[model samples]
Target: MLVKAFDKNIRQNKTTTINTNFVVIGGGTAGVCAAITAARQGTKTVLIQDRPVLGGNASSEVRLWILGATSHMGNNNRWSREGGVMDEILVENLYRNKEGNAVIFDTVLLEKVLEEENITLLLNTSVYDVKKSSDTKIESVQAFNSQNSTEYVIKSPIFCDASGDGIVAFKAGASFRMGAETKEEFGEQFAPDKSYGELLGHSMYFYSKNTNKPVKYVAPKYALKDITAIPRYKAIGKGDKGCRFWWFEYGGRHDTIHETEEIKYELWKVIYGVWDYIKNSGEFEDVDNMTLEWVGTVPGKRESRRFEGLYMMTQQDIIEQRQFDDAIAFGGWAIDLHPADGVYSELSGCTQWHSKGIYDIPYRSFVSKDIDNLFLAGRIISATHVAFGSTRVMATTGFCAQAVGMAASICVDKNLKPADLLEKGEIKNLQNELNKLGQSIPNVPINKSSNLINEATINASSILNLNQIPYNGDWFSLSISAAQMLPFKANQNYKFKVLVKAEETTTLQVDLRTSIKSKNYAPEVILETQNFNLEKGEQYIEISFSNPVPNNQYGFVTFLSNKHASLKTSNNRYTGVLSVFNGVNKAVSNNGKQTPPDNIGVDTFEFWTPHRRPDGQNIAMDISPAIEAFNADNIGNGFVRPYGTTNAWVANLNDKNPSLKIEWDSEKELSEIKLFLDPDYDHPLESTLMGHPEEVAPFCVRNYTITDLQGTILAKKEGNYQTINTWKFDSKIKTKGIIIEAEHPSVNVPASIFEIICS
Candidate 1:
């Protein structure tokens, strides 16, 4: 090392310039996804992250779990996990870090980005200035890294601003909103008033550990001494840690970006003050052995500047479940909001209201209205404050950002700007490309013209009849009304036989119900009711509705609550099949129902949600006429996931060697084949703190082989746990037909495939 003397008290740092096709700012969930997805789509991408690690709020520094449509399984959106790159990250995290260690999750994201050869990751770099080629286009960005004392100039044709605070968009002079809109502005009844607060706050979390031996703790001088100042300090608990303290928030009233450091200090005071109370106050016990293991140095920010785009999504778009022609992504999380006062407020921590189904997110919401080359993503995307409550979740933001990545690739290819893709055909092309990558838009199916499998005849060795779920000696009491949501065929008669046990003679009422809307999972419409008188002992009981299903949709076979009755449950769980209860998740419901204020632009409905694994077992029952939705012909239906119907082809549980064959009239050359498998989309894969029970989804195919006409294996994979599998041959494989053989991930669960494409 050499020391240099400064002349005239002037010094300079090394500077570098990099050229890329696309640039993604802030390596949070959205930016990481945008960069990875664009790189995978053949665009050279540069990812700039100010933090040392990727995964902004979800990183080990913040440790907030990644949750989206499957809102901790607290809502009725079934099979609603965000797909594409986000799904891959979550699935990989579940497989490797089911314990939900935040450090491991960080590694998962880093590995994903590193694996993509087209992505160049720059960590510990912050953008301080932006260069504009024109009033409407961004030419480059200037970033600096203090770690290496270097300045960087990155140039790109397209730029995506996924930074939570909207740094690039703000510096680029993009129009944006920082607070709530008036009720008259968008006819939004749920808009927060000035007194109630206009913005959600920032939060920090701490973790505690038990030391078998006693440990002492001392409060710092800066720690707050008064804990009772918080309105809900009694809600704190000994077992609570990390995200449980999501209410320990502040700084929403101040400018979130400029005053971030100040807000972090306030959060720190609250966190340490709360800990001091827990240790010193007489209210808690066994505290001598407890010690703080980790404390968040940086607070997780919730909201800031929402940039303007062609379309500003409002509360109506979410509540109405509106479909957009240029839809490229979907979100199902409830419209959740919090008061500006945060933990010190007298109001509850949050107010959440859910929609009946998932809603579409338009491409227009991501493209900047003023800047032609800028793509908005994450919580900074174009949306009213009322709508941001639902769209701000990490997974949902990442899903929308994936669409921006695909759009960026197309823009680079066509030498066009982001807004140029708004043309009908261009948007459709973007949608089709996203679907091919396993991202399913609401009510949108893959185009048939793009897949060669649609032109051939398909058959499977055996299709699952789904006649019965064998009992596993597990009995669950009917503490509340329970129902099995079954995908039933149109105009089909149904009868069920279930094993029941009663401590005393009880009257059991069985009702068949369906949703008023075909795509909804809520059981609101009662088709028929049947009453049965049961004896005191365990026995088999049969209930017949007599009425056939009116349409091809999911029907609920309900068993009303009886204090002395219990029903048998089975371990066999299948895709598009779940048992729900008429109960409250408390997180999204108020006493088993959503009773919003009249004319508040929200609905009143009961929540029917499924239980997590090792608990919400399927009801053991036998049906007279088997459900006919699981047929071999479904492989070519173009739908990759469950919609109004189960679009998957499921194999018989008894069939050991399940195989699907695609045949053509003459030999055809194919170089690539793709298969879409079921990964139990209903399960919420929270990235950190929320531990899962399984290493791989039970519905995933564990082993599979692809063979040609000569019975020679072209591709073979074992221990598979992903949703999308692709096979590319070094040379063309010419054959009249191709066969795919797969083994079920679980013995009780059958092997299933959503769609197969060959080209």
Candidate 2:
């Protein structure tokens, strides 16, 4: 509502009021992630950035890689792609234009916020003061932009300050501290022998390609007498001069930490001088032609303010890999420390690298010890210097953002505060929510292999490390009551199968759910089967879906539900039609190994479409008998159509039979079928349709001819003719896209074919 009015008196002009549910203070890495998370979870989130853009140091301003905890993969710790926002950005980088992690830091960061609809981003906005109710309870915040003298007020139930400096916490009277702590503070062994005020200096980095290109080496004007001989610690490998850490490169060591503005001013001179030395040395034919891509306006900050929280994360917690009930995220970055003294000083000592085992951060890291709703994210969370050294990375910060957002959601939904959820009972549900989004927390069963839901499948997962859990013999027991949420096709048939491999006699109880029902949908589950006890390897079973399958409604929109997450429709449509058991879509097919069945002592939920295949006379996905297990539901990203995928609908079935189903029309085509057997969660295989679609054209009689993705005749065969029979052919291919294309004989006129059969 815009009101056109004139103020009679300039001094009596009334200001406008702004309100939001979640007001995040800083717009750094964690702040962005937190705001995105909250918005994704259906919250009214507002992110206030004092700077022009969201990223603090890791943006165009600083130009730093968002490193997670170290990996044991190489010299550095492995990168965890399971992290959502961080992983999304990294994956997008892989897809976008990039030579070698040459990050387009700012644009990608902006895309993430824009993708989420619930978040409101504020740039060039600074939080100046806090309006607390009575005695330290913040009622609202006053923000002022220096560019414009006008000030604004922001009110919210929950707030997250992902600022590296604990900006909001300081303003809100929340307890916080800066600089390194004494050894006695947290009993950290890595603290300096005598705690000093010195901190890890910041870096004003610059990027250029082909640093190893032939160039004459001439020392800068300020270079020491024996600068080339100085010991250099390589932060980045592959023989680059800028890869060197320490020595402050061009600025004083203390310049990076205390006087950032001064350091920014000094770095330009140093970089130019270095380049001048190279140019004056007659390094190249065109020394003047060299290009400088970036000069960091935002200094790469290491240590800042550490806010006080209910539970201060410590190094002991990391060394022991301690599991907490409120676990929100994990980090394994080494504790890298730096010195405090200026250049040419031999007496500067700092701490780095605590232990080999990484650390687990609890939800307590987000909450301030003194504030009710204020949460801290990014490097300012309540972590000891050593532990902060690890969790401070951008990837780990994303996890905190995701976790704190869930907590904030709980606070809003349940009308509780951050402190209330920090206690034992309140945080369990929030942690569970984080686990589904792939947060690294203890006791959250990850990667469980389900043998009870599908036949021909081995319950296996890396997170579970199945090899360590001794196997048992005679694992092929027929299943009962195992639920599954798979892709179901209307009027199609499928077979569910599972094979349990155990070396010893063991009792395996797997809970499964092949169907979900709320106010709008009903149980479309025609079969919920399970099996028990097989050998240590391959098993076979099949459940058919030829009956009147269930297809209630493809899209259901619930506006009154929790946060109104589904956006397509309201009234979660319950179309009482049998799901197409057999259809012509890749995801509508019956079977192949996808996700490992969840049967880890009843703490996991997992399901997937039997390698869905979308092309054929009747593209169907089926498997053998269900592995004896537990509850299950539809496995999906929860959208009728999601980005980077085909338009499809997921179906859930519950029964003891290995039957799969799907729904499709003339949208695309019925050509080649595909089966994606994903053993590694990171990369799933795209192969022919379970070796069965290859041997049979789904639309063939007893005779069969198959084509590949390019419509090339890969195989041809002749046999008997039948209509009401089903045939099964096991797949044995070591490639992706296990396609089973229907061979069309161009030798004659175009022939119409439907209702494929093989038995």
Candidate 3:
């Protein structure tokens, strides 16, 4: 063996230059996702992270659990699962690390970026300086790697600033802001009355475990002296960890970016003090075997400098649920605002306000208005303080990152600037591409140009007849049953079916009603009523009527409770439907006895057990064409709700070899096919606040086969777990039609498909 001797006195500074199509700064969830999206689209990309580990706040350094649409299981928003790269990361996390280990999650994020062939990942690389072609566009960026003593000059056609603090955009002279806005600025009601330069604070979290042996902790000199100073100390319990300490924040009245060190020290004192209180204080009894397993050295920041873009989303847009023409992403988390003083404040920890449903985030919010080549993602995207309160979450930021990355790839291929893509009316093309890649944009239909179903004559072997499932066994009292309030237009006659169970011979009265005002949830007006005689068991009844509805109204159905009768309910409910109930009064039965509402106002949708009428007569076997599974709109609509709705195309359970066939007008060149299947979003993704043990849903497609018009088998897949499946052929083949045969995960359940596209 030969031993090589190295010279200790040698000193050298190495500089490296790399060119790529896109350059991404800050390898947080947004940066990692943006890089992956671009690389997967065949664009050469570079991802630079200041920290050594990936996932930023979600890493072991911070240990903040990734939360978005679900809003930490707050029980407000529904059907709000994040799509695109964030979905992939989450599904993978659930499958691989069921235990929700932070260390394993870090590896998962790292592996995703590393696996992309076109991506160049530089960990522990800090981008400090940027070069500009003019005052309007970024030309290159210079980053330093302290670990290797190297300087990297990265040149790219387009650059994304996902640094969370907008570092690249700031250095490149992009217009930005760093404070809360006044109420009159954007007509935002949630804005502070007096303008202030305060950002959401930074926080540190710790984990504790029981070791079966007594562990003692000695307080440091800088530890907080009195735990009584913090009013939220009651939240600290024996099993609390990670996100459970979201309120352990500080440094909001200071510069979040420049004063990060001071913030970290302040948070450290509080964390140690809190732990000291738990260990040394006599308040806790079971701590004899409990010890601090890990504490975060870095403070996870919430808000910082935000870049200015073509459009600045305001609080009114969120509250009004404004639908933007160029919506690329959606957010449903409430407008959660923390006190500026953080833990030191005497006021409550935070305030949250919810919308009726998820709201749209436009593409204009992701591109800089002045910086021609600069794009933004993460918390630094162009949004007012009130709007950022909801969009700043990791999952929403990841979707924004995916959108920017996809747009950057389009810009490179079209040889256009970021703003040009919008001004030239080319955003539709970008949106269509995103849809093909399984990114869901509410209200936007699938790309018609690529979906063969749009041009072909589509038919299915058997349509799913949801009415066949009889309404029996369970009966909820009308007074205590939570019914969803749907928006109804005036003078439009509509028919709906409901199942009524009668214990004795009696007359049942049902009334259609509406709320008195948009602000109130109580019903005040009865539009119409139908009286029916019921004998016994469950009987399906149809009600038809037309009435004038007030402007901006919520329509609901109420039934006068009969002592012997009850309304039947389906096992599942649809999204966007609100459960109508009295927050002030408890529900009372006919016997004058109080009973809890079967489905609370929190998680109820359509409660009426109704199905489509077939053959112009009320029959369960004959499926109506309007709600048939083969309807093209059912497969093209971007919305995927829970089963038992018209949004999804479902095949009957009895169809042994059911298949969907698309016959094109003529032979066309096809290379790829993409399918979006149901993932059972109603099933909570996380078992607890941490995460769920199982990653994949049982509702997802398990086995499927695709065949061409000539009966030539094109492909076959088995035991599928992913929500989106993309299949590519060895070469483009000319085919007039394609047939897809899918089997359900279980024999008695129907197979559901959301959307399908071919390109």
Candidate 4:
């Protein structure tokens, strides 16, 4: 090829236009979820991202751990991990990358997007302009990919704005708020003031590794010269890396969007300065062999330009745990806020205020108030600043974005706007659709319309009868108070017996506790207390309680802490039983109890959380008149997760072959069968840094087979490790009855199923 002389007129880059049913801007967690969900729901979708990678803050570039409800098991929100597509991705990541490598996580997100045939993903593409069909509707958007030197104009009927900076919404003239709102605006007593901070800031992280040999480093000219300028400089240690220094931040005082570059420079200076002190300051040892392995180029952004929607979620809604008729999603993270000065400020890095329990998110919060075709997601959803502090986490953002995705699909099918779904009879349809997709909405049961199982009689080979947890020779000291959470029926008198040992003669106190609300897990109401005098040697002691059980719910059989006593624990873990301790998880709670300032619109309570796997063994105990919650009838209850009671059908532990049989009055054609299994929702599937202990949920059924009344095998599944498993037959089968034979994943745990549906 020969080069010619440059002409006066310039040549334009290649341009392309694509038309689709839906468009999601910003390929962060929210955008990834929205685009994937819409595509799965039979909609043609396009996902656009300005960066080369997907996950916004959770990507390898930023490397912040993704979390939502079940916040590090720090609070009382048990079995609260998000469900549906977000759950699928988290579970899959845990199965593949339990080590939590950030680069490996990037591949997981890419694979999920690529697997969806209906989705089109564009990376390193930035949307610079927006085109509107009318004053109130966006028609298309203009974007350019720097890597390819290409311009793209994408047109869609519905659009979702999940960009961290609200780029598309801002260009489309959507109303938004940048800083914290005044207390009077939303009656938010916990709202931050001018001195406290108006917005949460940006943060960058660096990872360090040991070379095992001597290494040297020299600071560049731009590196910070003074480490003493940072008030918390002494808090930095030699071995600290990544989010261990999440407080190492800046850029809250300036414009977070336009001044991002300036903010990034400040963060880099702080990081390099911190590293320089760790290396050559001679204040620490063992760091001579350590070097910086990776540094974040893009800072993880917390908040900016929250766009307005139909309804603005406020602090009162979260604190009160208010129920909404249009509820579509849920959130449980604490209301966490940081200082404007970031790491340089003398104040603590964050202030987290947790509610008593999880709260519902309404569908209105995802819909635009002015723009007819616009949908808002992620940190841009409508909410007051105080409420945004809790809802801004990645998992919460991703779950709410799922609602937006499904709403977009419905809008395309019915030719209706987002507001149309909020009408009296239409909201339930949306909820029903979400339930069908495996989303566990708080207080929302699965809708059963055309399900064939609803008209059949269900029977199991053996239902779990609560009796005893055999001792495994493992003993735990009673240095802290421990409680066993078990399902108790209404108007029942229960007796519990446990093996106890005392170094000296001690008086052990046992109390029966329950939550004031039936659905909540917090044990605030003490029903009864009993004191038993124990001898110096190990012996079995029994306690009886006849307190009034208001309704069927999980009650806490608590054994108060005794310094001179110890109790036996069992390795026989059940599907719905858990043991908790009144202890502190310094990440979320400073002390074992939460005591807030008076009238701050937050609650004060004790945190009773379970220990992680290989440690959280069940209390060995025997009960008379065992719990009857796990029956075959529970399979048709329409609930797939534990609420006030265990909504699962668990077989007896000793049953070698557990099976379920469903019989109808007459033969009916069935095309598909779906089974919802147990996934141990108590485990918080953090994307990175916090690695999980198990690849597959220990309570899941590994193998199962379905057969008709004539004993002909219809479908079989092996090595199953997911929450939902579906069997679609090539042709409709006419059968009067069907039987499901399943095997437990482990001998310690029994086979359990939450729901079964056939159509």
For candidate 4, the per-residue lDDT at 536 reads 98
Model 1 pairs in collision:
none
> Which is superior by TM-score, 2 or 3?
3
Go through the candidates in order and give each one's C-alpha lDDT: 0.90, 0.46, 0.73, 0.89
Pairing residues by index, what is the TM-score of model 3? 0.83
By lDDT, highest first, what's the ranking? 1, 4, 3, 2
Report the C-alpha lDDT of model 3 over 1-759, residue by residue, as the tens digit: 997589788765799999999999998889988999999999999999999999888887887777776554342234467777787787777778766888888888999999999999999999999999898988999999999999999999899999988889999888999889876777766675432225789998888899977888898999998998888887679788876788899988988999999999999899889989998889988898888888888889999898899999988777666888889878876677788888987776776565545778999999999899999999999999989988998877887789899999999999999888878998888887776766777667566765766777777777764333333225666444344454444444546677777887888876777644442233456778778888788787776655644643445655665768776643332222233332221110112112223421122222121111110012121111122233445665554443123356677667888688878888988888878886644333431236663466655777999999788998889978777888988999899989999987665346777777777
Candidate 4's residue-wise lDDT over 377-410, tens digit each?
Answer: 9999999999999999999999888888898999
Better of 2 and 4 by TM-score: 4
**Model 1 lDDT per residue over 630-661, tens place:** 89888877788888888999999899899998
The whole-model C-alpha lDDT of candidate 4 against the native structure comes to 0.89
Question: Residue-wise lDDT of candidate 2 within 1-759, one digit each (tens)?
Answer: 998687686663234467888888888778887888788779998888888776776566655555554321111121122354554454444334233233455676788888878887778888878877755467888777666655778888888887677667888888876666666787765564333333555565555444445434454455334323223312222223331322343322343334767765555555544445445544434544444445556666667678889888876776556778777776754454555442223433233343333346788877888988788888888977667766776666876788888888888888888888865487767765665444545434322221111211211110110011111212212221222232233433444333333444433432222233211111223333233433343433233333423442221100111111111101111111111111112221112111222421111111121122221011111233321111112212121111111112111221112122221221222222212110111111111011111222222223334443344543444542221122223452122111232222222111112112110
Between the candidate structures 2 and 3, which one is better when assessed by lDDT?
3
Kindly give the stretch of ten consecutive residues in candidate 2 with the minimal lDDT sum.
Answer: 460-469
Looking at candidate 1, what is the lDDT of residue 495?
84
Q: Could you say which candidate leads in lDDT?
A: 1
Q: Give candidate 1's whole-model lDDT.
A: 0.90
Error of 1 at 83 (Å): 0.7
